[model samples]
Target: MTTYLKDLTQSIGYLEAQVVSLLGAKNLASMRGKGKLNMLYDP
Candidate 1:
């Protein structure tokens, strides 16, 4: 039972890392567009 719990925790951690990586990629794309817009307006 303890080993099962440990395996479950590791699986959850792996899923969380995948979610974070996906979000980071999306955020980077959004930020790149926003940065260009800001430069255009602020310059």
Candidate 2:
């Protein structure tokens, strides 16, 4: 029972990290686009 709990916790942690990494990459891409737009519009 204890080993199973440990495995479950580890799996959950791994999933959380993957989600965070994916979100970070998506946000970075969005920011990159905004930066390009700013450069194009600046006088």
**Highest lDDT among the candidates is held by which one?**
2
TM-score of 2: 0.77
Per-residue CA lDDT of candidate 1, range 1-43, in tens?
Answer: 9999999999999999999999989877887878876545553
Clash count for candidate 1 is: 0
| Candidate 1 lowest-lDDT run of ten | 34-43
| Tens-digit lDDT string for candidate 2 (1-43) | 9999999999999999999999989877877878876645555
Cα miss at 6, model 2 (Å)? 0.4
Judged by TM-score, which candidate is best?
A: 1
Model 2 RMSD in Å is: 5.9
Question: How well does candidate 1 score on lDDT at residue 12?
Answer: 100
